[model samples]
Target: MRKTKKKNKIYFPDPKFNDSLVTRFVNHLMKNGKKNIAYKIFYNAMKKIDLIKEKEDKTALEIWKEGLKNVMPHVEVRSRRMGGSNIQVPIPISSNSKITKAMKLLISCAFIRNEKTMSNKLAFEIWDAFKEQGEAVKRKENIHKMAEANKAFSHFRF
Candidate 1:
């Protein structure tokens, strides 16, 4: 297994959006391998967005993409052992990992939100993220703050 690198599995685009990012989000939202349920939740959230969207022109998919973009973190802290003490090293996240992290954060924030259903909660989170005012966005800002605080550890890049 160590002889070669793991190959990336191809992700088919979601039928509704015809977009691979949507498929990726659905994958992260799936639990117990319930892909049907995950797809249902995402589709329902899109419907909610259509109903309550502020702008008259932008589509739900566009808003969702904006939300996802707003949630991405550029820099994050990693713990590094320096001598007997551990230091928090601020490192830049790679492009692929950043997208994955953004999707996961959006899903997690939606789960904790109070709403009648997962779809409704996800819709609310999406709208909040679109406006850059949700927990996911806050998490990203906090990561930047921590990274700034650990600026001295920039030399510890691995």
Candidate 2:
């Protein structure tokens, strides 16, 4: 057991977007340490989003950020073992972990999409999230519902 919390490493922002959030997402999307490929996929998806929403006044980066914001969950459930039984406890999520969860959901949903390319799938997923109607958003809703349903158990939260 450690006495102190671990320190998070500072990440450099992406070159094109200059946002550390994008860097974090690309890092999560990276497979087998192929960070360049991950960055390419993300940038390509952003470009595709721009082309698709040419009529909209919003930029692709703005859309992506909004989408991620929409998918961030405020609460989640955790199982805790009590005296003689285990119970699910509803707990509020930390700001940092909320972003991590949203990014994971987006990437997982994108991977399962029936698109020819990773960029295409990611573009569609992000757009759906922006519109508040995607797997990531749906998952967030489900999590909220579960948290609400288990609100009585919140006292067990650590």
- Each model's TM-score? 0.95, 0.95
Cα lDDT of model 2 by residue, 1-158, tens digit: 65787688699999998999999999999999999999999999999999888577999999999999999999999999999998889998888899999999999999999999999999999999999997889989999999999888988878
- Candidate 1 on 29-142: residue-level lDDT in tens? 999999999999999999999999865589999999999999999999999999999999999998888999999999999999989999999999999999899898998899
Regions of candidate 2 where Cα sits further than 4 Å from its true position: none
Q: Which window of ten consecutive residues has the lowest lDDT sum in model 2?
A: 1-10
Q: Pairs clashing in candidate 1?
A: none
Minimum summed lDDT over a 10-residue window in model 1 is located at 1-10
